[model samples]
Target: MSLTLRIILLIGSLISFYLCVKKIKQAKLKVENSITWMMGSFVLILMSIFDQAVQWLANKLGFMASVNFVFFIIIVFLLIQVFIDNIRLSTLNEKIKNLNHYIALKENSDEREKNVKE
Candidate 1:
């Protein structure tokens, strides 16, 4: 690879690592999430280093190039993650709604009991 390309990849890898660390420190990302991000970034760095090897495999497999394959993989992973996140959020929302309903019912019952006592 060209010196420029190598330098750019190094910079990108460093930036990704730094961001992942910062997110973990700030509690913005859980440990598991940070680990996943770090692993993805590491894979990107490896792809950068072994680009030629990847290209050779791509060629053998009849794909266009390594870069294209990497992009496709990243897109698929992102879509799957988004789907999982949506499912988790929906479940959380349902739980919150159920809790709210339960609290309302309890309050109503308590009020009725107080009125009867008086």
Candidate 2:
């Protein structure tokens, strides 16, 4: 990795980490959701600090350049994050559907009892 790239990575990761913390402090972001951001920032920081290791790994992984490896890692991490979010959304949707069905049934049952009492 070039010195400039390493410096940029370091700065970017630091900024990302700072933003996550700021959002959490402002109650704009939940800690659970911020965990992935924090972890990703940490990984980038490590990569920036260990340029030699990044280069070696890139070579071993058959990437033409260490920068390409960094980008690949970032893309993969984002994909995983998106998958996790989708799973959470799916679960929430199922719960909402079940709750709506239960509510409809309760309303129907109540109406029948009211008619019987009348």
Best candidate, lDDT-wise?
Answer: 2
Residue-level lDDT tens digits of model 1 in 18-73? 99899889989888767766877787678778878767877788776565776776
TM-score of each: 0.82, 0.88
lDDT of 2 by residue, 1-118 (tens): 8889899999999999999999999999999999999999999999999989999999998999999999999999999999999999999999999999999999999999999999
All models: lDDT? Answer: 0.78, 0.97
Clash pairs, model 2 backbone: none
Candidate 1 to truth, TM? 0.82
